[model samples]
Target: MEAVVSLDARGQILLPKEVREKAGLRPGDKLAVITHVHGEEVAYIMLIPARKLAESLRQFLGPLLRELLGPEESEGQGGAGPG
Candidate 1:
């Protein structure tokens, strides 16, 4: 999907409705912009939701913590490992 938007005087660009809908972005939602370098070629832009990223991190780190600290550790530590 491609979208073209103009930056306002305040240096804010409004995302197109279609692009926002496709990306599941909504008003007041947080976005993380990622830029990639490719040997001086065209850079890549990635937009990710902050909440989604946090959720993904939690999901991935849960089992890793369990493996390192044992499954019972979470229970013994007052469920602080992942909640």
Candidate 2:
């Protein structure tokens, strides 16, 4: 989807109604804004629902943590290893 929205005087831009509805956003829902910077300038911006971001992080990190900690340690035998 492509959209061009103008930033209001308050430094806020309103998402198009179609965009909001398609993203399943509700009035009070939270969004996580992600940005990519290139050579001191922001090149791109993205948004993901906060809950979705947390779920994605958990899915990705849980297995990696389990592997790093080893099976026995992953079962709650200890805390994080040396950095």
Candidate 3:
């Protein structure tokens, strides 16, 4: 699917409703933009669902924290909580 979206003066692009619905994107959903550059210019951009990125990051980094701090400390109860 292709969408021709325009950026406003504030640099925000409104995603067409059809596009959003097709992608299963809803209000408050977070997206991550990845830019591919060739030399001096950006060649293309890709949008990734942020939750997907977080899950991927957690899979890679979560174990390292457990190894560094030990299992008990890795548990939330032994770690810092929101103040």
Candidate 4:
């Protein structure tokens, strides 16, 4: 889905109704703005739901965290519980 939006005087862009509906966005939903820089300018910008962003990060990091912390600690056993 592609949309061309304008930044209003307040630096705010209103999402097109179709785009919002396609993305399942609702009033007051939080979106994370991501930008790609090309030298000194922004090449492009993307918006993703904040909830999805955290889930993506957790899915990507969970394995690495588990490896670094070991299975016991990763699974919340707290490693220092019993002697």
Candidate 5:
């Protein structure tokens, strides 16, 4: 979706409601702004939610942690013996 927004006096721009909804963004959601040169004369920007990104990382890291820590660490930490 494409949206046109104007910057306020403090140089803040609000994302349009439709655009926000389509992107699954909500109030107080954190975003990462990235800028790049689209062409020789044009620049492009994107916003991504930090929480969503972190969630993705956690999903990917789960198996790696299990492999590194073993089954004992997976159950719990510092126990006298297995029940």
Candidate 6:
């Protein structure tokens, strides 16, 4: 879905009702602003739900973290605990 939302003087854009409803955005929902840069300029920006973005990041980093920490650390113990 595409929408052409205008930015206010405060640099805030109001999401269209249809767009917001389609995306399941709620009044107090947190959105993560993502920018896509092409060359030296920003091509566009995307707003994703913070919860969804976190889940995606966790899924993406899980394997990398496991590799960095190794088998002993991946088993939920026996490594340097949180600081």
For TM-score, the strongest prediction is 4
- Order by lDDT, highest first: 4, 2, 6, 3, 1, 5
Q: What lDDT, from 0 to 1, does candidate 3 have? A: 0.82
lDDT value, residue 77 of candidate 5: 41
lDDT of 2 by residue, 22-64 (tens): 8899998999999999999999899899999988887787678
**Each model's TM-score?**
0.68, 0.78, 0.64, 0.83, 0.57, 0.75
Listing every candidate in turn, what is its Cα RMSD in Å to the true structure after a full C-alpha superposition?
A: 3.6, 5.5, 5.1, 4.9, 5.9, 4.9
Please report, in order, the local distance difference test score of every candidate based on alpha carbons. 0.79, 0.83, 0.82, 0.84, 0.74, 0.83
How close to the true structure is residue 68 of candidate 6, measured as C-alpha lDDT? 91
Q: On TM-score, who's better, 1 or 6? A: 6
Candidate 4 regions exceeding 4 Å error are 77-83
> In order, how many clashes per candidate?
0, 0, 0, 0, 0, 0
Model 1 lDDT-worst window of ten: 74-83
Model 5 lDDT per residue over 1-83, tens place: 49789889999998888888998988888998767876674387777788877777666765566667775784464322335
* Maximum-lDDT candidate: 4
lDDT of 6 by residue, 54-74 (tens): 888777876777789886676
As for lDDT, the candidate ahead, 1 or 2, is 2
Superposed on all Cα atoms, model 2 deviates from the true structure by an RMSD in Å of 5.5
Better of 4 and 6 by TM-score: 4
- Give the per-residue lDDT of model 1 (tens digit) for 3-73: 77787999889888888898888899999887898999758777789999888877787777777888788
Q: What C-alpha lDDT, on a 0 to 100 scale, does residue 3 get in candidate 2?
A: 88
Expressed as tens digits, the lDDT of each residue in 1-83 for candidate 4 is: 47788899999999999999999999999999999999999998989999999888877877787779987786683322233
